[model samples]
Target: MLCLRSRTQDAWLQRAIGATRDILVDHAHCERKAATQALMLLGRFPDVTALVEPLLDLAREELEHFELVLALLQRRGWTMESLAPSGYQAQLHALCRKAMPGKLVDLLLVAALIEARSCERFKLLAEHHPDAELRDAFGGLLAAEARHHAVFVRLAGRFDDAEAVRVRLDDLASAEVAILESMPPLSRIHA
Candidate 1:
């Protein structure tokens, strides 16, 4: 019985590690996407050059993180796989309006929420995972995600009408919750 329990625990840990790896890959992809999106937005709104520089720096950092995650995967003899489309992102994208100011505000709020959730999940995984290396990686990722969240929040604040932003954030949060709750079992974010 002891041996069986030990095997079970080991299996669980392995699965957790695999899940974490996949999440890291997905996160790297998100960073790349965000960087590109920010650049495009900056180009469209040239007047926001000051706001764009920070985002450009963030993109570069995210790409570097992607490289790190790729190296880690290679070291572990794990091949990165294509991830299924995430409902969380889709839900956020849906909130973005077609117009200028509204579009920018919505994007910032959605980005902030995504970063916030990523930070929260990284903390949870770091605490719960059995592997020391993975735990440490998650810990570092948690800090980065927190910083990313702060950046988005700061960017969002630059816009006019604090109350309007707050209301939109609330709406996005509600939609995010629904997306998480409604996802199928294959979605590991529910874990």
Candidate 2:
């Protein structure tokens, strides 16, 4: 099993099922951001064997997911709106370490945590959502997100001490959950 230390709340899932248009819009932003992050990592560590090919593939898949989500929003007559700031991401990012190879390890751990949270949230929606279509759609994404999370975890091992990565991951994940608790109980993909 994945070693993520956080799980989304039940109330959050209930809120998300009702506000799918908003969630889809946020999901699109998430996909775009994921792709951008992957590319940025690629640029920063172009020669890291563990990151190069996987990050490239992640970028491609995330971009595709963005397009798919945007299309879904359009089909629902919901125009892609201006992006909003994500307190969740902001808080998690603030926890990243600021040193060399350590910085890279932190980044990978953060990515893994985010993907793990996404997978958890999607799994919740798949099981509890009232709409069959929404359930099916999110269910389809569960495997992909799980794989992304796993890949990031595996990549973090390229560091001097994978144990240290896990320690920081646990710390950041605890921080992330605290941040989530402070957020509004709204229907959002990341909420």
Which one wins on TM-score?
2
Clash-forming residue pairs, model 1:
none
Model 2 alpha-carbon miss at residue 10, Å: 2.0
User: lDDT per model, in order?
Assistant: 0.67, 0.82
Provide the TM-score for each candidate, comma-separated: 0.81, 0.93
For all predictions, the C-alpha RMSD in Å is 7.9, 1.5
**Residue-by-residue lDDT tens digits, candidate 2, 1-191:** 66656667667876887788888888888889999999989888877877888898998988888888787788778988876686788777777778978888888888888888888888998899887876787898889899999898888877858678778778877876788778887567776
Q: Please write out the lDDT profile of model 1 over residues 1-191, one tens digit for every residue.
A: 00000111233334545676675566556666666766776777778866777788777877776777677677777766787676667776887887877888888778877767666666766887777876787787777768877787678768748788777777877777666656654424322
In candidate 2, what residue range of length 10 has the lowest lDDT sum? 1-10
- Regions more than 4 Å wrong, model 1: 1-18, 187-191
Question: What lDDT does candidate 2 reach at residue 17?
Answer: 77
Model 2: colliding residue pairs: none
What lDDT score goes with residue 76 in model 2?
79
